[model samples]
Target: MIESRVLTQDVFEDLARHARRVEEAPWLEFVHGKLEVKARPDGNRGQIIAWLTRLCLQAYPDRWLHAYQGLRTETDGEGNARPDAVLAPIDTFVGQGEWASPDDVLMVVEVTSYDEDTDRRDRVEKPRAYAETGIPVYLLIDRDSCEVKVHSEPDGVRYEQVVTVPYGKTVTLPDPVGIELDTEPLKNWTR
Candidate 1:
């Protein structure tokens, strides 16, 4: 067997310290006790995120749709989540302060391309976190499995409702944006 690289607690403390230094720092998700750094979505992942953002823009000309590694949410100390696509109310996101928080997010979207376990993380763990923080909608796009999961209705620690859609179907945002994405384009997103 190969050797392992273990990250000590000090490293996470250092990262947290660094995280506070930058303006609009990259977002990171904490799983287990370790940290997973966030990176911009790759070309294939970016394609779908971009398309969906465009669809959101067309759907709600007033608000804003942001994607990739910059959105922040509170789940823990410095709790930041860089969802693939996040919808924010224009009123809260004018130009300063906190553009988006857990409560301000109308929807948080994740498009999975690689990482099998990461897919599951978004499915169960992140949904719970989002619900705990009272985000209205959690949209998950499983490109590999050709599935879409919509988690709404924050109940206790987890969202009470889970609606799943397959490739042929479309997942709709109930209100706010009131739009639909033809999830078929995401059916064959293989990395």
Candidate 2:
């Protein structure tokens, strides 16, 4: 097996920027100081993000839901995460360069893809990274598991509360993102 190389934050950022300029290039994320390529969203995944965007818009008209917003999850500048979606004040990311700070972000949303890395990237690494960044909420819509996991109450290292409910159920996002999600529509997008 060939050994994979780790990239520094600067090198990763440069590559990420270059990739953004090319059409149909897979999204790049730096996690744990390693390069991770995320496949472009399929139709089902796009629909899920659209559904969540509508809900967020209805809940907080003053807030904006940014799809695929890159965030600096580590204070030490170790890695960057591009959440499926992020809800924050309308102008929170304005004028902020690539990889904005997560301070103003109210919540980060991740819709798991059918890829093999979903478990490690979305389910495991993301929660820890977002929590460490002090993001108020981390919403994981697990298509493989057919469940929604709401993680909140970040105390620096990890989210203290993790509430999991299967699809077709009602799940309430906690403080900082007080929105009720009717996950029934999510079932339509699940694999």
Ten consecutive residues with minimal summed lDDT in candidate 1? 1-10
TM-score on alpha carbons, each prediction: 0.75, 0.94
TM-score attained by model 1 = 0.75
Segments in model 2 whose C-alpha atoms lie over 4 Å from true places: 1-6
lDDT of 1 by residue, 86-185 (tens): 7875565556333234556788888774764575567766786677677888888777677888888876478787888887787776654467767777
lDDT of 2 by residue, 74-126 (tens): 65657789888999999999988879988899999998888888899898888
Top candidate by lDDT: 2
**How well does candidate 1 match the true structure, expressed as C-alpha RMSD?**
5.2
lDDT of each candidate versus the true structure: 0.65, 0.87
Model 1 global lDDT (CA atoms, 0 to 1): 0.65
Write down the lDDT that model 2 would get.
0.87
